[model samples]
Target: MTVHLQQEQQTMLWTLAMHAHDAASTRPILGDRYAADLLDRVDDPPRLGLSLAGNTPLICARAKLIDDAARAFLARHDEAVVLHLGCGLDSRLLRLDPGPGIRWFDVDQDPVIELRRELYGEREGATSVAASVTDPGWWAQVPDDVPRLVLAEGLLMYLDPEGVHTAVTHALTPGSTLVADTVAPWVTWIAGLQPAMRAADTGFLSSTNDLAAAAGAVNLEDELSLVDATATRTGGLTSTAIRLFALASGGRDAMVLRTYRRP
Candidate 1:
């Protein structure tokens, strides 16, 4: 399936990110099926042909944090809804096994969703919607009665600061919880060091050094956490790789695990 260069880049990054998760899940502590599924798709011709390099392990570690957050939500809410914004071609619905009662919405632009529909679109308890995350109308499709667990992995960095604020503000419900990952400003500044990564065509957008502040701008409570990829090695890159990148770039932190809740 041919797509625009930017769209193809996004798909490649997502695929690599999933592979990293699969690599990390080999560790007893982070045995995640979602990671495994991501690894399976890496060889698929349509999603292949991208250079992952050191970013692979970091992607996996980020994915584990998302899995952990999802598990937390599942444990607390019986009839929960998962909104995976900018879902790309990920198969988390199948890997997470949110059960029959749970409702899952995997959303992205129409083109990406169309591809997703062609691939893993037939699962029960899962539905795909074609819409940009910035659109307010997409929220109407989500039922208000059930608690929502929004997973925005690798999506925010592409949006302007205000865009991120808007997406979070509109999506928040009383019991809603958000799990996302973003790069620190320093990391964004030095992203060019990895020449192979530039192919992603990420719109060259990023945010402040602190993600908590970004979340706070939208009235969402924030908690900043670090993913210990070194502890669990499933493996594209490791915490050491992240640290090395930070060191090479004169950065204090590279990636962050951000959780948000409405007060």
Candidate 2:
């Protein structure tokens, strides 16, 4: 399909790439069979170019962590609400098919949602909202009494600091949890140098060591990042090199997956 997403919106391609990678990889980290199925229907080229080749492991690992976290959350709360923020063309709802009582909202802008609808038809409990996640109005549509889990995968770095606060703090209610990834400052700088990012006219805008500015009632439960996963997925000299770099650089200065819970 010849979808016309805005330049910034095109970042969804990376998430789609990760899904495809997982489905296509021999020993898939995510084992997202739904991803490969959806990808075959999307009409976009599935192969990663040299410019974006290196991102496969990083993106897939990030997704694997999120998938694990989401599965754990669903296990705890069978009837909880889930917000797949900046959802792109992801097939997460298919992968983590929650219970009958679960309310899942896969959100994104208009064009992306349009494409998503074309590729994947309507489902029973999952709803697709066509709106920018930065906007708080979307929250009004969501019922507030139940617990919620916000999965903001590969999303925070693209938002400004203010946007991050709005998304994490205001968008979520008390008794909810948010699982998101943020690139450290150096990662932001390096992201600007990436040809694929530059080509999409997209670059990281938020880079904070702490995602706590607007986390009034939330506390960080866990902190996981790229280096934590890169070595596990790589082998031989590459695995050693990644582990060594992670050891020296430590955890705080790398791209990370952070889970926060609201009281």
Candidate 3:
């Protein structure tokens, strides 16, 4: 079946394509073996050129980092709720395979959730919620009593400042943590210049240079630079260039994975 998506939603396919490419490569970073199969279900999936293909390491590395964090969080709390916001078509629930105690919710737009239902059907411990992450009403579906692990991978950059605040605020309940990947202010500007991004009419709408402000009253636990992770995951000339970029940019322009916590 053919899957239709809007410009921003199309990005999910691109990310999935990247995962599929990484899995096929000799030195796989994320090693998402299921990505290839998922990509196959999409009719006429996005074609990745060298420009898009180059993002494989960075994208896959981001996934790896989130996976590690989620796994660790699940191990710590036997009863927890995972809110994978803007989940798209990612098979992270399948990848992590958390124990029975964990309740995982994959949330996205209604259309995206409909597509996801068609693809994966019903899962044991995972539920797909069809609603915008910015909508406060969706929070009712989530259990606030359990330790919440809110994942906003590649999702926060698309929201405006107020929307980001809303997402962060709702996620910072007692004993909850929010892990999100956000682009820097400069990266948002740079994304506007990309021909591909421009052609798709979809670019980053928001960014944060200050992690503390982004975290608000919550404690900023950790920050991981995607550029640094890419350099480590991809050794060679690419690694050298990334290292130099990190030094020159001081990681201010790199995509950062940030963890925020509320005691």
lDDT of 1 by residue, 120-235 (tens): 64788888888888889888879878888899888887777777777877666676778877777766766655444455544435754434555664454454434345334533
Q: Compared to the true structure, candidate 1 yields what TM-score? A: 0.78
CA deviation > 4 Å runs, candidate 1: 1-9, 12-51, 208-214, 217-227, 230-252
Candidate 3, residues 46-151, lDDT tens digits: the string is: 8988778878889999999999999999889999999999999898998999899999999999899999999889989888899888899989879988899999
Comparison by lDDT, 1 against 2, better one: 2
Among all candidates shown, the one with the greatest lDDT: 3
Whole-model Cα lDDT of every candidate shown, in order: 0.65, 0.79, 0.87
Candidate 2 regions off by >4 Å?
A: 44-47, 250-252
Ranking by lDDT: 3, 2, 1
1 or 2, which is superior by TM-score? Answer: 2
**Per-residue lDDT over 149-200 for candidate 2, one digit per residue giving the tens place of the 0 to 100 score:** 9999888888888888888875557888988888777888888998877888
Model 3 root-mean-square deviation: 1.3
Alpha-carbon RMSD, each predicted model:
4.1, 1.9, 1.3
lDDT minimum window of 10 residues, candidate 3: 208-217
Model 1 scores worst on lDDT over the 10 consecutive residues at: 45-54
